[model samples]
Target: MNLRDIDLNLLLVFDRMLAERRVSAVAQSLGLSQPAVSNALARLRRALGDELFLRTAQGMVPTPLAMQLAEPVAAAMSALHGALNQSTAFDPATSTRSFTLAMTDIGEVYFTPRLMERLNQVAPGIRISTVRNTAVNLRDEMEAGQVDIAIGLLPQLKAGFYQRRLFMQRYVCLFGKQHPLAAKSRLTLKDFASADHVLIQAAGTGHGQVDEQMAAQGIARKVRLVVPHFVAVGHILQSQPMIATVPEKLARALAEPFGLAVRAHPADLPQVAINAFWHARFHREPGNRWLRELLTETFAEG
Candidate 1:
C-alpha cells in the first residue's frame, strides 16, 4: 500500500494505540473521544486491508501486520515530529506549556526547589510537574512525548536517547550528631560494619550500585531498615544510632537541618553520575532544549 494513499493522521492514532493497547487510553492520551479513536482505527483497517489490531478482553491486541509496521511507523512519526518542532521558537516568558519530568525521590529533593525558583523568576507561566521514574517506562513515555525529560541515575534510558551528566557524587554516611561514629571526621570499615544501617533501596535508580560496590569488597553492614526512598533517611538517622549511606551532596544538605553529621563512607563506593535524559525525537524541540539547558545551568557541578 502506498503511504500517500492513506491518511497520515491515522498513523498517529495507530502509533498511540500500539503504545497504549486500549482504545480508551489512546483517546485520553491523544485528547480525542473514544469513538473518534475507534473510527480512525476502522478507517486505517480498511485502507491497509488488514485487521491491524484485534479487540480482546484485556486490550486491543496487535495483529501480525501491526507488529511488523510498528517500528517503521514509530520512527517516521518521531522524525516528522522532530521536523515540525525544529523551527518553532520557544519564548519561556510567554509560553504556558506544562512539562512533565520523570525523577526519583532524590532527584525531586535536589532539583525541584532550584528549578522552581529559577523558573518562577524567568518563566513564570511555564509549569513543571514531576512523576517518579519507577512509576512509568521512561523510554516509552519520553518517546511518546508524555514525559519531557528524566533526571537521576536512570540506566535504562540508554539507547534512542540523549544524556548529559550533571555531576558525579560519591556515597557518604549520615549519622546523628550524638552517634558514636559522628565523633570521627571519617568513618572506618569497622565502624560501618558494627553500626546498624538504614539501607535506602532507591529502586529504579542506580543507587543499587552502592550496595554492589560494598559487596565487592566483602564489606557487610547490619541492615536494620530497608526503605524505598531517600526522603526519610535523614530523619531516621537523626533519631537512631544508624548510619545511612547516601549521596554526598544530599548528606550535606540534610546534615545541619536534620541534626545529622556527614562522614566519608567507610567503604569505597563508586561515584554515581546523575544525568538528564531526553528522547531523540524531542532533542531539537525548542522548549525541550530550553528546559534541559536550564537543568544543566542550575545543577551541573564544576
Candidate 2:
C-alpha cells in the first residue's frame, strides 16, 4: 500500500479502539457517533490489511497485528498531543494534565510523597499514574511516549534514552526487632548466610547473583522466599523470622515504623544508583524539563 494514500486520522480511531476495546467507548472518547467510529475502523482495517479487531463477548479484541501496533500508535498520538499542547509559558497553577511514571516500589515509596506535595502546591488539579518497574523493554516505552519518566537502577538500558543520576544508595540487612539477629550490633557473612532470608528480585535477576556473591566468600544464605518488591519483603519480615536485604534509603524509611532493625551487609555488595530516564525527544520540551528539574530537586533533598 502507498503511504501517501493512507489517511493518518484512522490511526487515532484504531488507538482509541485498542484502549477502550468497545466501539461505544471509543466513540465517546473521540466525541463521535458509534457509526462514525465503525466507519473509521473499516477504513483502518483496509489500510492495515487486517480485520484489526474481532467482536468477542468481552469486548472488541484486537488481532495479533493490531496488538503489535497498539503501543507505537498510541505513543505517536501522545507525542502529537504533547507537541500541539506545548506553550512558551507553562502555568502549572492552571494546567490540568496527567503524567504517567514508571518506577520501582522503593522509588514510588520514597519519591512520590514529595512529588505529590509539590504538585498539590503548584497544580492542584494535576493527576499522576505510577506503573511497576519490570525487566521489560523500557526504551520502546519512552520512545513511544507511553511512559513519561522511568526511575530505577536500569543497568541494561538501550541507547538513545537520556539518563541522570538521582541518588546513590547501599543495601542493608533488615530483620524484625524481636528477631535473634536484632540482638547483635553487626552481622558477619556467616550470620547472613545461615539465616532464612527473603529475597527481593525486582529486575528478575534471580537469586543467582546474590548466591554467587556469597559463594565468593564461601557463604550461603537460605533463601526461604523470593518476592518481587521490597515492600512485600518488609511485610514478610514484620512477623516472620525472615531477614531481607533492601536498599538503605528504603530500609531507613521503614525501619522505625515497621519495628525493624537494620545492619550493614557483611560482604562488599554493590551500591545501587537510582537514575531518572527520559526520551531525547523531550530533552528540550519545557514541561518535561520542568518535571525533570522537580524530580532532581526532590531526590537531591533525600
Candidate 3:
C-alpha cells in the first residue's frame, strides 16, 4: 500500500500492542479505549497485509514482519517524542557535551579564543574540537553528522543547508617596520604590484581574488613565497622583506606584537564575508541553536 493510504499513528498503536500483548492492556497504557485500540490494530493488519498479532495462550504472538519492525518503530517513536519534548531553555553549566566544528586556520586564530572564554564562563565542562576545512565532500560530512558546524567563506554552498553571514573582512597589506614601504601611510597600486609578496594560499591555489583584482588592473605581484595559513605568513614577514596580503583583522593582530605595519589595499579588493553553516536537520535542534547563538555573539564582539 502507498504511504498516503496508511496512518503512521497506526504503527505506534501496533508497536504498543505488540509490547503489551492484550488490547485492553494496550488501551490502558496509551490511555485509550479498548475499542479504539482494536480498530487501530485492524487498520495496521490491513495495511501490512498480515495478522500482525495472533492470539494464543501467551496472550498475543507477533508475526515475523511485526517482530522485524518492532525495534525500528520503537526507535522512531522515541526520537519523535524526544524532538517534540525539546527545551528552548539551554543550560550550559551542567552540560558536558563536546561540539565539533569545521573551520579554517584563520577562523580558529580569530574566533576560538573568545569562544573558549565564553564557554569557560558558561559551560566549564564543555569541550570543542576543530576540524580543518578541506576541499572534499563537505555536504556528505555534514549530513553524516561528522561535523556540527561549518564556518568559512563558503561561496557556493549546496542546497539542504542553513547558512548565516557572521562578519565581513577586508584585505590589507602587512609589512615589517624596517621595510622601505613602511613610511608610506597609504600604499599605491604600483607599490603593491612591484613589491615582493607572500601569498597565503589556504586552498593550495597561488591565485585568488586578489590576483584577479590585480589582473583587472593590468598589474601583477612578484610572488616570492606561497604559504597555506595567515599565521605562517605573519611569522615569515617578521624577519623577511616579504610583505603579505591578508585579512585586515589578522594583519592588525600580527602587527601588534610582530612590529609590522598595516596598510589598506590601493585597489578595490573584494570583501570576504564569513558564514556559519549547518545541515537543515539541525536547524531546530536545541544544542545546535545554543552553539550558533554563541558563535554569532562571539564574532560580533570581534
- Among the numbered candidates, top TM-score falls to 1
TM-score of each: 0.84, 0.69, 0.71
Q: State the displacement of the C-alpha of residue 101, model 1, in Å, after optimal TM-score superposition.
A: 1.4
Model 1 shows how many backbone clashes?
0
The C-alpha stretches of model 1 lying farther than 4 A from their native spots are 1-7, 27-58, 61-72
Model 3: per-residue Cα lDDT over 1-302, one tens digit each: 68699898898788677556789877997899999999999988887889988999979888999878765675566557558867555678888888889887777887788899999898898999998756465654664456889888775554557887888888889989888999999999889878999877777322267667768878788999987767686678888987888888778777988889999988787887778998665666677778999888778534
Which lDDT values do the candidates have, in the order given?
0.86, 0.78, 0.78
Model 3 CA lDDT for position 97: 84
Q: What is the lDDT of candidate 2?
A: 0.78
Candidates arranged by TM-score, highest first: 1, 3, 2
What RMSD does each model have against the real structure? 3.1, 5.4, 12.0
lDDT of 1 by residue, 8-28 (tens): 989999999887888999899
Model 1 residue 188 lDDT score: 78
Candidate 2 Cα deviation (angstroms), residue 238: 1.0
- Cα distance off (Å), candidate 2, residue 46: 23
